[model samples]
Every structure is written in structure tokens, then in C-alpha cells.
Target: MFISFEGIDGSGKSTQLSLLRDVLEAKGHSVITIREPGATLLSESIREILLSNKQTITSTAELLLFSSARTQLVEMIIEPALRDGKYILCDRYVDSTTAYQGYGRQLNMEHVELCNKIATRGVMPHVTFFIDVAYEQAQQRMQFTPGSAEPDRMERSGREFFERVREGYLAIAKSDPQRFVVIDGHRNREEIHADIVAYL
Candidate 1:
């Protein structure tokens, strides 16, 4: 099964994902974890370009770049792993494109959808977890983290953008309830992990 976790920058999706990966591994499942715009040489290169605040990239260009990375990842890593019967656990996936590019960037959703379909070549997650956390709370967490990593291009996009992205995620989940498992991210780490495991 292909499982994906999604949310805003500081929404704890990564934390929950790590815990779930450990649990699944302990249960004797062959789990392979991957982060979007990464997990392959070419994809990592694309990730650097996407995250670099130093560069000025157009919205359409950004969308295409992300799709390029996704295409590389799916063809080189994701598809092969699935063929080998490994369970894939992804930190983010196509839904992120729809949220960040379509909603956050206010791009055309139809174009974003087309790019995503081309990127993954019809490879869809069996289940997706959308960690629900308020934008202010998430921002506070990022601000308070000790030695926090420098904010990326998207992370620095401001509160209003993230709010739109959050709404986008909720809308996507509402439209596809069967594929999406929405979890409250305000809870403790263990609690969130338990909720995800319940779905698995």
C-alpha cells in the first residue's frame, strides 16, 4: 500500500510519519519512506531549486519544476519499489501540488491537475493522511523550534498563503474521503501516531 502524509510546514506530519514508519517497521512491514521533490539524485537537485529562496521562479515554472521532480521520483524510485512489493510511505505527494500551487499560489486548478497526472503517471496513494493544524499554531511551532532550519521559499510565503493551503487540503479531503484520513494535529505525538495506525 502507498500511504502519504500531508500538511502545512509545521503541522507535525513529519513527526507522525516518522513514528508510524517505526511502528510499521517493527511490525515486520517493508516500509520505504520518501519525501517529495527528493529521494533520487535528479529529484534532490530539483528540490534544491524549489526550496532556494535565493532564486526567483515564476508560479508556472514552480509548478512544472515540482512536477519534474515527482516524475523523476515516481519513475526511478516509487514505481520500482512497488513492483518489488514494498510498502511506500511518502511525506508529501501530488495533493501538495494542488494545495500549494493551485490554492496557495492561486494558479489554475485544471492545469495543476494535469501536471500532477502527468507527473505520477496515474500512480496514486492508497491512503493519504492530512494533519489538521491551525495556521497560527503551526507558525508558532516553527518560530519556537530551537535551531530551526532556515525557512524555504514556500515556508516564507507568509500566513495568508498557508491559510489558503490549509483550506485547500481540507477541500481536497472532503472531496475524497475514502482516500484521505484527516487527523487533528494539535494532539500529542503518540496520539497522532495512534490515529494514523488505526487507519492502517
Candidate 2:
């Protein structure tokens, strides 16, 4: 089974993803956890460019660079791993592009969808968990976290942009309810993990 986790930054999705991976591995499943924009050498380079605060990248350029990184990840890592019948647990996937570029950046949604198709080449998760966290809480987590000494460019997108991205995530989930399992992000880690495992 292929699964993907989606949420805005500091939504606790990564924590949940890690917990899930551990649980699945304990159950004798071959869980392959991967983060987008960093699975391949080229993708990791693109990730640095995307997150760096030094250079000012245009909105269109940002979208294309992300697409390029995703394309490389899908072709080079994701597809082959799935062919080997491993359970892939991805930190983020196509929905992120839609939420960030399309909604947060106010880009064209239709164009964003098209770009995602080209980038992913039709590969999608069997199930996607959209961890629903309030924008205010997510922002607070980002700000107060110890390792977050310097906020990345995307993290500095501010409250309004993140609110829009949150809404975008909900809309995407609403449109594909079957493929998406929306979980409350406010709950305790163990509780949240229990809910997610129940779904599986």
C-alpha cells in the first residue's frame, strides 16, 4: 500500500508519519518513508533552492522548480520502490503543490493541476492522510521550535497565506473523500496514531 501525508508546515504530520512508519515496520511491513524534494540528489538540490531565503524566486519559477524536483523524485525513487511492492509512506505529495502554489501563492489551480500531472506522471497514493491543524497553532509551532532558528522562505509566507493553504487542503480532501482521511491535528500523538491505524 502507498500512503501519503499532507499538511502545512509544523502541522505534526511528519511526527505522525514517523510513528506510522514505526508501527508498520513492527508489523513486518516494509515501510519506505520519503520526503518530497529530497529523495534524489537533484531533488535535494532543488529543495535547498526552494527553501533558501537568500534568493528571490518568482511565483512561476517557484512552481516550475518544485515540479522539476517532484518529477525527479517520482521517476527515480517512488516508482521503482512501488514496483518492488514496498509500502511507501510519503511526507508530502502532489496536494502540496496545489495547496502552496495554487492557493497560497494565488496561482492558477488548473495550471497547477496540469503541472502536478506532468510531474507525477499519474502516480498517486492509495490513501492520503490530511492532518488538519489550525493555521495559528501551526505558526506557533514553527516559531517556538528549537531547530527553527531561521524560518525558511516558505515558512515565512505568513498567516494569511497559510490560512489559504489550509483551506486548499480541506477542499482537496472534500473533493476526494475516499482517498483522503482527514485527522484532527490537535489530539495527542498516541490518540492520533490510533485513529490512523484504525483506518488501515
Candidate 3:
């Protein structure tokens, strides 16, 4: 089984994914967890460049970079693991590109969808859980203290951008109800985990 978790940064998708992984493992299932633009050498390098606050990358460039990293990850790790009958739990996936680049950045949907198709080579997740959180709540969660690590380039895209991204996720979920599960992120962690586990 292939499962993907999607949400804006600080929406708790990662925590839920970790929790689900633990539960699945305890049940004797082989599972592998990975994050987008990461989990592989090439992808990790791209992740650094993509997230660097100092770098000034255009929206188009960002989309291609993310796609490139995804291609490498899918080819190197995800595909093989799934073939070995392991459950793949991904922190983020193609939907992120659609939300961030397609909606947040206002890129052409056609181009974004084409890039997504090429990147994954049609390998989509069996299920995608979108943890929905309000923009204000997400911002509050993302706030950093003095001397702490600063927000990444993407994280600093401001309110309007993330609002559009959130809308994009909701739209995507609406379009694919069978594969996409929208989970309210305002609830307690245990409640959210219960819903996810119950779905599985």
C-alpha cells in the first residue's frame, strides 16, 4: 500500500505519518517513510537548493527542480520498495506541487500537471490524506523564536500564497474523493491519528 500525507508546513501531517508508521510496523507490516524532495542523495541536494532562503529561484525553476527530485526519488527508492511489498508512507507527493506551484505560484495548471505526470511516471499513491488547517493557525504554528532556525524560502511566501495553496488542496481533494481523504487539522493529535488509522 502506498500512502501519502499532504498539508501546508506545520499542519501536523508529518506527526500523523510518523504515528501511522509506528502503528503499521507494530502490526508486522514492512513500511518505509519518505519526504518530498528528499530521501535520496540527489533529491536532498535539490531540497537544500529549493529551501535555501538566500536562493532566488523563479516559480518555473522551482517547479522543475521539485519534479526532478521527485523523479530521482521514485526511480531510486519508492518504486523498488513497493515492488518488495512494503507499505510506503510519503510525507508529501505530487499534490504538493499542484498546490504550491499550480495554485500558490499561479503557474499554468496544464504545465504543472504535465510535469507531475512525467515526474512520477504515473506512480500515484493508493491514498492521500490532506490535513486541513486554516492559514492563521498554520502561521501561528510556524512562528519561530529569536535565534531559532528561520523559515525556508517556501515557508516565507506570505499569507495570500499559502491561502491559495490551501484552497488548491481542498479543490484537489474534492476532485478525487475516492483517493483523497481530507482530515481536519484543528483536532488533537490523538484524534487525528485515530481517524487516519481507522481509514487504513
lDDT of 3 by residue, 1-200 (tens): 89999999888888899999999999999999999989999999999999998879999999999999999999999999989999999999999999999999999999999999999989999999999999888777667433537889998998899999999999999899999999999998899999999988
Clashing pairs in 2: none
Alpha-carbon TM-score of each model against the true structure: 0.97, 0.97, 0.97
Root-mean-square deviation of Cα positions for candidate 2 versus the true structure, in angstroms: 1.0
Q: Give residue 144's lDDT in candidate 3 (0 to 100).
A: 41
lDDT of 1: 0.93
Per-residue lDDT of model 2, residues 1-200, tens digit only: 78999999998888899999999899999988889877889999999999999999999999999999999988988899899999999999999999999999999988999999999999999999998999888877778777666888898998899999999999998899999889999888899899999998
- Give the lDDT of residue 183 in candidate 1: 95
In angstroms, the error of model 3 at 133 is 0.3
- Candidate lDDT scores, in order, read 0.93, 0.91, 0.94
Q: State model 3's lDDT.
A: 0.94
**Candidates sorted by lDDT, descending order?**
3, 1, 2
Instruction: Using lDDT, give the best candidate's number.
Output: 3
Candidate 2, poorest ten consecutive residues by summed lDDT: 140-149
Cα RMSDs, all models: 0.9, 1.0, 1.5
